[model samples]
Target: MTGGAGYIGSHVVRAFQQAGIPPVVLDDLSSGHRGFVPADVPFVHGSILDVPLVARTLAEHDVTGVVHLAGFKYAGVSVDRPLHTYEQNVTGTANLLTAMADQGVEAIVFSSSAAVYGTPDVDLVTEATATTPESPYGESKLIGEWLLRDQGRATGLRHTSLRYFNVVGSGTPDLYDTSPHNLFPLVLDALTQGRTPRINGTDYPTPDGTCVRDYIHVADLADAHVAAARALGEGRTLEPVYNLGSGDGVSVRQIMTAMADATGIAFEPDVAPPRPGDPARIVASGELAARDLGWRMTHTLADMVSSAWEARRAH
Candidate 1:
């Protein structure tokens, strides 16, 4: 699995391990911590862009498939560094595909993002939703999907992409989301550093006057990835993409409340001005994934917050 040492990737690695599958990890450790990988798992410290290295690792492990989660993932930052995003997401994906083809690894489960939908005009996003990505990061992910589709046509590569919104919580206390830009880590960092957790744009059109988003637990998302990989291995016909989302949504205000309760913090969050281009709400229907990939909201809002808080504190 590429990037198996990172946040979501590490959780997926553990899921694979729990299923009696030992995975070899290839990570550059850019934003990933080496400790996130288990001491028993074979770890290769390298980037997917290193085509020779990836091919060698695949051959060494006799890998049958790939779980790709490595990339430049910050949507906001991608706007200012479009070239860097393409290098990491687009070009890096192309290199991984090349290595896979070279090593005869014909299956992959791509860790895509809901950013491909951008600001959807519909009430609920689905597999058929029009893709009009607003940032370089989203565009790169969309292009990565295109790469897989094109490769499938040419080389019969079996592939599927999992699109998701905010991923929260940890499956175990030993792992946590450490991205400086992600919500759970940001809020937890603020609280840990003796600063107030602030909520941006609390006057949206939602019931609680904050932006609403689909927040799925990382463990549930990891399960879906494993299921997708198994489906590919079994030659099951699967959709090209699946959205791992909450049918309903949770507001930022709700998240703040949960954080306070979970952390035993008494202070209310400070309301700040809305970030530019911040949508009032973005939620999707996970019905397709539920039907095909065993996707479901296995964790409640409180579960998401409390589990994430526990992991962050342990870290």
Candidate 2:
């Protein structure tokens, strides 16, 4: 797995490890910590853009398939660092794909984002949703999906692209979303640091006057990926694109309420201006995944928030 030391990537690494499949990880640690990775797994502290390093890892490990979760995820930073996001998200994926192909790796599971849908008019988003990325970060992820699809079509490289929503709630004590960009992390940061969690806006079309987002617990997301990989191996050839989420749109206020209920900490959020390119609502349709991969999510908002709080308290 590439970028296996990062937040979501780390959890997926653990999932693979728990399944007794140790994957060689290629991470530059630009935004990941070595401590997050399991000791049994071999770690290569290098960028996937390093063609030689990636190729060597594939060859050395006899890599069969990859779970790719290495990419920028912040919408705000994407505006300031479009080039960086492009290089890291787009170029890096291209390089990794080339290396995988050269090493005879035939299949892969890509970690895409719901940002590819931009702002959907419909509340329930499906794999058939339009591709209109709202930021450079989102654009990069969409490009990666397209690249994966194109490669599969041209080279018989079977692939699955999972577009995840806000991933939170790691069941493990030490596992959670620790990235500065993730919503759950930012909330926890504010609460633990004696600062008020800030809300982006209070005038959205949502019932609570705040933007709504679909959140899938990290563990459930991990399960979905494993199931997707299994589906790949089943020769079902599912055209490789599925939206992984709770399929329930929860608003900002709803999250605060859940967090407060979970941690007994009053998250008095300071309302602020809207993010540059945020969507008002994004709910996913995991029905396709359920039908194709026999996958189902296991965590609700309350469950996710409470489990996240448990992980956060430990930190």
Candidate 3:
């Protein structure tokens, strides 16, 4: 697994352990914490761009597949540093594929994003919808997917790119995200820290005027990761992509209200203008994954928020 030390990747690692499937983790510790990973699990501290190190790590682990999660993920950051985003996301992905192919590792489950959809006209975006990535970060993920799909076709590398929406609600309080990228943690931290939780906008067409996004529990998404890998490993057909989401949209105010109700804390939202290129709403349809992987979501909107708040307090 790459980027296994980040918020989503670390949870994926724990889910692998829960399923009795151990994975080798590769992280540069650029934004990820080393203490998040268990000591018994073998971890290589190196960038994916390091070709020699990647090749060596694959051979040492006997890795036949990967959960590719390492990359710069912030939409705003990508905008601020397009070149850096392209280099880390695009070049790193190329090197990962090369190292994997070199070692004859033919299966991969890529950690894609809902950002690929951009601002869809439809409320619930399915896998069949045409991709129109809005930002550099989204563009980088699209490029990564294109590379994965094309490479898999040429090399018989069975692959699945799970297009994930908002991945919130950390199961492990010890490993909550400190990064300023993710929305849920950012809001929770701002509120808990006594700083005002800023709402991007209050003038969207949505009912609450705040941008609405599909929030899937990290654990649900993590389970789908293993299922995708297993399906590819079991010689399943080359359907290499699937949308993974709750199919339920939650606005910013709705989330804040829910957390406030649950925690008995008044959420003082600081309404600010939406950032440029901010999509009004992004909701996804995950029927394909549900049908094929038998995946079901366990958390509700309240659960997702309350759990994050609980985890935050614990930390």
Best by TM-score: 1
Model 2 backbone overlap count: 0
Model 1: colliding residue pairs: none
Kindly provide the TM-score of model 3 when superposed on the true structure, using C-alpha atoms: 0.95
Off by over 4 Å in 2: 273-277
Stretches of model 3 off by over 4 angstroms after superposition = 274-277
Clashing pairs in 2: none
Q: After aligning candidate 2 to the native by TM-score, how far in Å is the CA of 146 from where it should be?
A: 1.5
Query: How high a TM-score does candidate 1 get?
Result: 0.98
TM-score of each: 0.98, 0.94, 0.95
**Per-residue lDDT of candidate 1, residues 90-152 (tens digit):** 999999999999999999999999999989988789989999999999999999999999999
Root-mean-square deviation of each candidate, in angstroms? 0.9, 1.7, 1.6
Deviation in Å, model 2, residue 243 alpha carbon: 0.3
Report the lDDT tens digits of candidate 2 across residue range 95-128: 9999988898888999998888888878899988
Name the lDDT of candidate 1. Answer: 0.93
lDDT of 3 by residue, 1-315 (tens): 999998888888999988888899999988888988888789999999998899899999999789999999898778889999999999999999999988888888889888888888887899988899888999999999999989977987788899988888877777676777677878777777878778889999999899988889888888999888788888887466789877777898998788778677786788888978667888888889988887778788887887788888888
lDDT of 2: 0.84
lDDT of each: 0.93, 0.84, 0.86
